[model samples]
Target: MNAPAPPPAPRPAKPLFPEEPAERHTLSVTVDNEAGVLGRIVGLFSARGYNIESLTVADVSPDHAVSRITIVTTGPRRVIDQIHAQLERLVPVHSVTDLTEAGPHVERELALVKVAGTGEKRVEALRLADIFRARPVDTTTSSFIFEVSGSTSKVDQFIALMREVGLVEVARTGVAAMARGKDPA
Candidate 1:
């Protein structure tokens, strides 16, 4: 009465991949500030089908030979690792560090937000801006351009509230990130 080994115990169902969920990451890459170096780095992302949420680059050295690029993107953890490895292999890229994972870091983005409203809506907008510590960089009778600098989430929250009031347009300086300690990225 073996009973066919009880049908060999039912197997659990599982997805073919079950890949890790994608998450936002900020990557800081130090590279040689030369012609076509940025293009090559961007090409790598395009070739691999990755998307860049925001990108900013500026020379960091007095000699103008070194530059730092802050790239914001979202991808699975494994894909992020791949990006780091590939970036390091680039000829001009000196180093690639994941600021989101590297101990503690500071990230900030500046946004110029325009809101157009009148009466109570206008007053409400001003009140909200004050609470957010936003400065009115430009002001006219009909509208005000607020200059806000803070973490990404803070800027997003402010923009969302403005939409409910009278959000006109926004100019943002993508994320700028750096490691907190003395160690260089």
Candidate 2:
């Protein structure tokens, strides 16, 4: 009978636990600028065991009634979708947009990096900062506080390089993201 139908066609076995690589997603949440609102939003993430890579909040409305919160996190696609849904259910949240999935977006971060070194290290640090278009906001004999702003990866690279030269401290403003084109994110 056709060679026993080739042993009934072996079937591929599915793994018991499917592994999905975590994906980074930048979410823009619009909420009322009121007391405890930010706390509640932040609490949700903590309660769910979700980690926030970057978070930035600013009042956007002219009257300071509305605020825009940019939160960057990494998780599986299903987890991201769940986060979106939960954010939408918040009472003060006006809207939640996944800028990463929405298409082309621009994300930038500002970092105040402090490097301490002498001689060639100092010169090298300055040279690297100049190459990255970072300006020296403050300078002293042994250290310099640089104001660097650019894409997240660029800032990270600059900081890593500075570490080799003598990175003392770093203050990052987190990520501020916006969708491309004319539409508001």
Candidate 3:
């Protein structure tokens, strides 16, 4: 007689809540140009333990009645969605757009990088800056302050290269992002 086959191995159970990978997000928030608006917005992030990687604010309206805030943060998808929802509920906020999810967008940042050196280091710094298209906005006998503007990543790479040559100080303007198409973000 043939032996009975053993019971098939049981399949592994799936997790109740699957872990979602964290991702970087760029958010554009339009709001009334009023006092304390920025403070309140920043408070929300602080209360929730969320970190703001980069932030830039400006009055985007010709009438100066409206302002735009661009923020870069990192978190899970769920958290990011919750943040968007919460921001919309605030009284000052007019609209909250997730640029990262809104399709093609343009992001740019300006950086002032100062390099101090003499001899070969100075020559190398100027050479690298020329390659990166960074113009010398201020130049002295010993140092040069170069202004570079581009995507955040490009600015970062330029700063890194400057550090190798003779980077001394750096000032960044955070990030300004906008949707690529006709739609406003």
| Candidate with the greatest lDDT versus the true structure | 2
- Give Cα distance to truth, residue 3, candidate 3, Å: 46
Backbone clash count, each prediction separately: 0, 0, 0
Residue 71 of model 3: what lDDT?
Answer: 95
lDDT for model 1 comes to: 0.92
Highest TM-score: which candidate?
2
- After superposing candidate 3, which stretches have Cα over 4 Å from the reference? 1-18
Worst 10 residues of 3 by lDDT: 14-23
For lDDT, candidate 2 versus 3, the one ahead is 2
Stretches of candidate 1 exceeding 4 Å from the true structure: 1-17
* Model 2: lDDT of residue 151: 95
Q: What is the C-alpha RMSD of each candidate to the true structure, in Å?
A: 5.0, 5.8, 6.6
Name model 2 segments beyond 4 Å from true. Answer: 1-17
**Candidate 1 lDDT tens digits, 15-105:** 4336788888999999999999999989999998787989999999999999999999898888888888999999999989999988799
After superposition on all CA atoms, how large is the RMSD of candidate 1?
Answer: 5.0
Residue 70 in model 2: lDDT = 97
The sequence of per-residue lDDT tens digits that candidate 2 reaches over residues 111-152 is 999999999999999999999999999999999999999999
